[model samples]
Target: MSDIIDIASKEVGYKASSGNKTKYSAWYGMNGAAWCHMFASWCANQADVSTSVVPKTASTTTGMQWFRDKGRFKTKGSYTPKRNDFVYFKSDGASHVGIVEYVSGSTLHTIEGNTSDAVKKRTYPLSYHTITGYGVVSDYITSSGDNSKGKNAKNNKGKEELNYLKKILDKNTDKKKKSKRKVKYKISKIRPGINLSVKVIVAHGTAKYKYQVQEGMKFSDERKGAPGKLTFTTFADNKRKITNGDAVAVIVNKRKFFYGFIFSFSPKTDGTLEVTAYDQLRYFKNKDTYISVNKTSTALLKKIAKDFKLKCGKLANTKYPVSRIDDNATLFDIVQNSLDETLIARGKIYTLYDDYGNLRLREPWKVNVLISGQTAESYDYKESIEDQVYNQIKLAYDNSKKGTQEVFVVKNSKSINQWGVLQYYDKVDSKKDIKLKLKSLLDIYCKSGKTLKFNNCFGDARVRAGCLVPVTIKIYDQKVSGYLLVDKVTHTFNNSQHLMDLELSGGDFDSSY
Candidate 1:
């Protein structure tokens, strides 16, 4: 466990790289926004705090409300700010937040973001007028005591080395390779009897919004789609109107870009339509349903899809009994929860999307592309120990027939020695087949001792999220190459360049795995 202060101190001098956007924005899914609250959330996330302890948000008011709701908040003058607590204040009639560094006498020191557009330490008197309250985060703080002093010194050394390496790479312009591919994007409206394409202005989507892997790719409680917008012109007559709930498609470079549907559309005076679209799952979002079953998890899911007239594919055969489950949730809720356990146990994932009005559920596809200096414009590499790589997992499940809870444990002793015992727990039915499944999962994910994230920008319009791509890049004055599984991808198109921001994980090139 890492101390909260230690995690935050490492990023004290952080600043926005462009506009109001800092790398910390990625942590809260809000770029180009005031980031004081985001900085605090990022620190909590790095400390591995549960959502119940610290609800994730970028808005200052939302963060303060979460702390207050949890009874961890006290009025500013009512309590002295402690180390690792969140301090909320009103600046210019707007709320802002920061993480408390320490308290000395009546002076409260804090680490805040968006303060003069950079992260820096600031001090204030306990009775400052702008102060609102303090959120106690001491319960979530894990300490190494004086041992953290040594770790901080070692981290500073790593930063110095990284800075020196960056200088060397910046001077090596000869390594850059020129690309010959052209960039283009177009939006298409596909209905029962027509297909139309138009020039697109801008397109953007974040996996954190609607395509979240952990949340079963469903939109937020207050939203309906993965949240996407398109600006385009319709040259045809106003006969066929592209209205809400209409199935639409986006194409770039003569390829099927996204299979989605129109959420809302507005026509402009210049004969253009600003259409908002989401993934195909938006079509069945409001279908309320009920199920009371004593069936296998897979069987129950298939039955739900069939009753709803939905098409499902690539159903892997892993029979696990899920009995006496009664719920009044939607069809999506049932299907998503049925497979949630498998996802956590083995990293297995499934998606449901409409393929041109045909709803389909199946495992996502992988694309293997060899990205090098010639095909990529810019690339960056990041590795962090906070990713929580597990080499051992303990599974506990209730055996109603046996009247006891059975345990299944799997471990890699070599990994435990090298990286320590990173542990995980899962609730699964006690079956020999399920235990075998857990063992196979540990063997695959336990090989890597650290988490490596690769960010690459290239001109490939075919690259999409969930695709497996091989990367070969030189960083830290050394060549780091590996095949990474793409977690999220963003396609940015413009007149000068077509760029893709890809977040990739898994697979290590520096180790013997």
Candidate 2:
């Protein structure tokens, strides 16, 4: 074992005193505080490592920054761990600060402080998701020669490092910069072993970097029809930085806002790059002939996604089974055909959307999402009777037992008088209840098309199409409030600000032909 690892290993079984006080924290003059990073710094100091090589900070964030600033850090899958290397782990939770004791093939035997309130030895796979990256120590120039990369630095210039470390310790640790460069959007390569070691391109609109966003992300989806789309462009250092077919994800305010695959892009003469990406359903737009039997919408979506090698997330079961044949229908049309049949028969709404790259089929929310004045900056509401509104529904069925044609009708007299004779006609199964089916169709069809759109709505990272969102607006001395279906949403991230434009519907749909 290396001297750094050996020194850290001897601290095994060391536990904090009452009130979480530890020798490392005490050495750093911060008793009762977290000391994993302090423990690493202390170990490096005992081994006479230079402050320039290994930072003497008690904060993991500070340590990570120090390593990142020095160009000595490698994200997991990009580098192999060696003895004496410091590794970082897990985000959105208690992160890790561990020292590698040894590398045995694919496993990393590590010695970490404060693993269960004590110094403990642990083992994990080299490709574990919790591992963020490693901080490599450059080979140190010592009296024994240059062995710093693998050898512990001796006290050749210990006095200078001690003074440097003392200066850092004297500073106010609580002092922090208000803004730092962040990688809000991460576009990664979509292939086998994704998230393990694949290449990822990160872009940001940080004011510090001065790369302002010229084009923001736009996303839209039909409730139960076409595939959703996520498209945007940012500054690219080189044309090869982003290639068509690469996977895309937009992380807004630390949460996922959109996910898809790149399909097309164009580069400007001034180095600005414009690109377009679409969800898994983009493949569904390809026309193909397929016949389905005894399959629900969700079932057909999953089947087609699997057949096309697309990833599938949660697919909620749909309520209706449909049998149909399309000579040459776009894959999306086939899925929509099933969705139409199911909703018409069962009066249920099922949505197909990509949830952070994995395509999902789910039912839209029935409950309300209350949107206060603070939530929406401005909104435009439109109600129309000219298009896609009917007051009467007529279904013609052939009765095999009676050997005759049957006509079923359900109409709203109030709607017919107010909106004129707007009739919807379709064919139905003779075995089903004609009266119930006609009434269901009438309720769905006999309504004015109402659409509400919100512009520059405070960006909610969780908001997306196919979900229910509440909207409250007071316009023209009229108050409108309640839940509405999100038909489309576009998020604009510019100058370090995040906003979205949304088009909402009141579950308005046209009957299946």
Candidate 3:
């Protein structure tokens, strides 16, 4: 036997002995239930085989279906037995695990956990059907030459004895056809990211088997004709009936433009055959750049060009041309006015300064606002805040009948405040409430909540305690406006660099004035 099979068997033995009810539970950190996947995972880990173990919650039927979909291995009822393979039996809303020992004709000898008490070896008849598909752990097999000596010799001797018994039980083969041996081939492995060189041994018959490798072709230029023709050939053909000391190869060329190799055999028969086709193309990171296009931004740019009768060039090829009358100047104007209203609603203070470096307030005094709150210091925290507060709010607003809510600037003659407005009362109230709703929403979107922080305020925006300066909160509305204010504020900005201190209060009113 190969090292991989020995390792797999040893792992199975260890797991079977470690509490039959919870065999291999340490792998998944679940100690209460019988986990067949955990058992498989543990065995694969020992065998040094890299494979993903689906969760125990996955139905036995689903796991069986996956094996069936592979269309490999033999089945006898519900129990398909193979060396180093996992056998799952339906239990109480879950499944049980077992390891194959040896096949006695149609009867399978297996080592199983929690079967008739603890881990034990038992012989199950082939008629005890319900056999899910078999799982082949590794393609490596022991050569007939290796088994001709030492401990393997004894095992072979035992196997020969068993084969004799099997032959005695079956009395139907004709003596004339006995000279024509049966050929069997078993697939080993397919090296990924390159052309496949499949290896298989012909067990009987005339050892030569024709192999063909085909490429999935697409017409590169249909206007002219097909690009090129493809040809396949067998690399090696070892004549004479194959036993243990023989090997055959089928080489496939993997060109950069080719998709994958499609392997086939001539005169397909019920003989054992191993074929592996490698996927030449892999998931390249740069390919994602081609798949991802900022469609919304592209559409918006096109719409702007059409509406204004303006000529727009490709972003990659040219710089944004500046106009005497700035087209984007209106956007800044809208943002400024909205910021003022938002500030007032949040009960915060802000000052608007014009382009000439002059305060727009009537008092013309540099007012200072002191903000007290914790600041978020990590990238993860900031990202979580944005995902919660901004992204969630935007998504909710977009899905609502009101379309997108306008973030307005609350402004009085003396002060400006920034606040996000929600048209309907569908959860969001305070920052804490918003964070909670965002967590749930993010979980729904990402299918996992590990990326978000549950409860943590970002930070206050003031440079020093009790120190306030002339500030203006720029809100993104349809237009910009200015307001002036003087106050002491305590607020946490989830994700902002310069504008953190400002709490929204019900008493503070939002007005354009």
**Candidate number of the best TM-score:** 2
Ranked by lDDT, the better of candidates 1 and 3 is 1
Best by lDDT: 2
**Model 3 Cα displacement at 172 (Å)?**
47
Q: Against the hidden reference, what TM-scores do the models get?
A: 0.41, 0.49, 0.25
* lDDT at 143, model 3: 15
- lDDT per residue (tens digit) for residues 1-513 in model 3: 222234333433333443544645654467545555555555444433322221132235655645553333345453334444556655344455565554556676665544544445666765654444455432222211111111121122122222322342231233225425442223222222233332222223444543432232111110010111112223333443323323233222321221223333332244433332222111010110011122222343343335444344332111112111111113222222223222322322322221111112111232233111222222121112222122222212222445444331211221112223311113121122233333333322321112211122222222211122322222222111121222222222111111223212111111112
Instruction: Per model, state how many residue pairs clash.
Output: 0, 3, 45
- lDDT per residue for candidate 2 within 381-420, as digits (tens), equals 6768876577887777656688787887888999778878
Give the lowest summed-lDDT range of ten residues in model 1: 212-221
Shift of residue 386 alpha carbon in model 2, Å: 3.4
Candidate lDDT values, in order: 0.54, 0.64, 0.30
- What C-alpha lDDT, on a 0 to 100 scale, does residue 332 get in candidate 1? 56
Evaluate model 2: give its TM-score: 0.49
Candidate 2: give the clashing pairs.
Answer: 139-148, 139-149, 140-148
